[model samples]
Target: MAELPIEIALDDERATQRLGQDLALALRPGDCLALRGDLGAGKSTLARALIRCIAADPGLEVPSPTFTLVQSYDLRIPIAHFDLYRIADPDELVELGLDEALGDGAVLIEWPEHAGDALPSGRILIEIDEGPEDSRKVRLNGPDQAMQRIRRSLAIRAFLGAAGHDDADRQFLQGDASTRTYEAVTTAGGERLILMDAPKRLIGPVLRDGKRYAQIAHVAEDIRPFVAIGSFLRDNGFRAPEILARDLDTGFLLLEDLGRGGILDDQGLPVTARWEAAIDCLVALHRTDVPRHITIQDGTAHTIPPFDREAMLIEVDLYLSWYLPHKLGAEPSPRLREKFHAGWNGLIDRLENASKSLVLRDFHSPNILWQADRAGIERIGLIDFQDAMIGPAAYDVASLVQDARVAVEPVLRDRLVARYEHARRRDPDFDPVPFREALAIMECQRATKILGIFVRLKKRDGKPGYLRHLPRIEAYLRRTLAHPVLHPLHDCYTEAGITPSES
Candidate 1:
């Protein structure tokens, strides 16, 4: 690939540091940066800034590696900082573990000239020089791919600047199981916000009626749904993040920083009070008459799709397509497949006629934040609802009581169900028997679908961590399918040789 060179002028130390931080966003494991500059140049300063940004630690102490020759950091990705000034010969590089460092993680090397022919190809080269008025000038040269990443990083910097947060310190935040990424931005004035980098969803292969799986599954393809849903939630006095600024075209949103107070405690167990608050939030949501269609500022109406039979069937079929083959290493026979479909179809028939509400499909622990200062349901901050659908209210209740990632103790789950039932029973139209049945059916369906999804994540996406939750989901499925209404599903599982006891 051809190399592209770009020049940047830094008027002060902050500008140089900002450039380093921006560059850090584009870096990945195995990438290398060769720093070239004269004595007393800003090479160490820029390297320190880059390391700290990648580590998400602003106050990290990064001493010059002048004496040690090399210093490594355990950032989100491992990084090695090498000051090669002390090296007498290029052959000495191997003795300093440079080759091993380059293989394991990214490296930032100062005085690349001393390395001679030991320098690798495709590495980014940055040269710093003294400029007029005590300023600094930086020239970057790298391969096409690296240059492209740098361009994107620069674009993000410009976007933040245009949003009136020019000097915000960016720190990488945990992303969801989607293409979306996030960064926590802290401004110069100490204001914190979340920067969402959700690019437009790529259209996948046509599934049904020429619609992609994303469309058929009711996944949000852009930021419009999130903005509309968030507005709707806030309008109804819920604790959705307040939008600070947005570039809809770029699919970037600057939102209020909902603090990291999750429903789970440090031991990965549920907090009773927080869980109760979450139940209250769901009760309030289900009681409200949410419109299927909502109008945003542009006057275009965004409609929440129904959890129709086709969508539900496609979701449940993930088990046959991914989980069974991947986990059990056995394909279901035609008879078993037919029975599975027949069972789910029968359950779907019951759900189609049930009372419907806004179903936040993933109303579990990870997506919920606890805000103690707030009162009642408002204290439960909601996130990850862009894929919300109009579905049976019991679906969300099942999701909450039988969380996929964490274990909700059997007793606590029963208590939550009782609390939810009590709240819903207050409505004149609510029927206890049907609600309980629907919750059980939905629980079984969710577990079945997640079994496939977790397997798919391991096989297709190379994420094996999700596999650990399979046993938990299996246990939930067994408990739910024990309901008399799910007898057909239990039979199907037995025929397919996937009994919960084996899992």
Candidate 2:
């Protein structure tokens, strides 16, 4: 945390000022600048000058992010400058995905006082004040390494400058399966809008196209079930955020932004409480009925293909090829591979009827955002749900218990399975044998899909970071199947030559 740079008096731009050309060259990658000033404070003037100098395009004037909110440049390095003075809302900054650009390189942020904590550190904070005549006082803040250079460059000058509830927009307690969630949003008019960014093309709650399980229902008319689900949760007094607007064409939703902290990140809590809240969020959804008139027929008819045995096997085979051989260092004999597939296929059939529950298909640690301030129902927020489906109750439980990103304690996994079963209507006397079977199979199902997805994200989309989590998926598969409960599956993995990291 370097200190902000000190100010040095400077005359009018024509007299004694740090020219933008020099400033541009001085500002290198990884620079985060804070520009402070009053109205007509010349902040924009300075920024524009810097932009031209950095861009080396003499006649170009960068448009303000005021209306666009953010203008990105494809220079030698990406430079994003934000003007918050006219920024309609604060949290909207997160939607801009500036966080992604934060570490990529330097960012020129102006009227930053309006953006607040969104600013990244390790750069300069400039303050500009209107002074007598055309002269101005500028105060600059920065790391010591750049302080003297900053002071010699742009002179620093000092300067400048949500709660709510709307019922029409419905929100769901996002606990599991919803990914990269938008918690809450504050509109420029001071309206508190809850937002979720679900691009049906990517991953989220509602799936679109033929990808109902992997995408979102972008069209409002088509999203009735999703909205109905949200409304029901909200009306039932479940703590879910509201969806304010949806760009169905693009699958982006402007919903309320829930605050930080969720069960996903809390490692200090007891296993019992963690499992309890997770089961509760699921039970609430199962109890949530679509309006009597809006029969499951319509929802069911238009529903994307069920996550059936075929789909489950398709997912499992990916692990067999991509994950197993790579980790185990050898391919399984043909007989073992055949048996593994057949056994997994049998397990998927068993999964089809674990007392059907509204499965949040990706319910897991990373999908949950827990809140510390919450008392009861408001505790765990769900996400990545656009993939919701009518799958076995154990499927969601397995997704949570055998998380791909983070491992849940085995104690917690056992407790949640019990809690979920007790909340079931038909399976009160359900055997853990079958449930545990479903859990291992689903864990196998989940890990395989994610491994393929991660490989795709990296090889195709050029996002390699997701690969780091593959080992966790591998570890879960080995553990879940290692139990005497799943020895059949475990032996199959070994006979199939999976995971040299033998149990």
Highest lDDT among the candidates is held by which one? 1
**Residue 262 displacement (Å), model 1:** 1.7
Q: Number of backbone collisions per candidate, in order?
A: 0, 50
Per-residue C-alpha lDDT of model 2 across residues 1-503, encoded as one tens digit per residue: 65555655667863222344335645667777777788777777777777765565646768877777678887755688777777667787788777766667667777888876777666577788888888888777677876755443222111000122221212222321233223232333555554443333343344233554332222123344455555545677766667655544333455555655556434544345755887787776665553332223234433423556555665666556555555567765687678777777666666665555566676766657675677666677764454455566667777777776666666776777777767664645456567666666666667656776776556555567778977676676666665444454666656534443334
Residue 165, model 1: lDDT of 86
Runs of candidate 2 exceeding 4 Å displacement: 1-185, 189-228, 235-237, 264-272, 287-305, 324-337, 371-376, 422-433, 483-492, 495-503
lDDT of each: 0.87, 0.59
- Model 1 lDDT, full chain set: 0.87
Off by over 4 Å in 1: 1-6, 88-92, 116-120, 141-145, 491-503
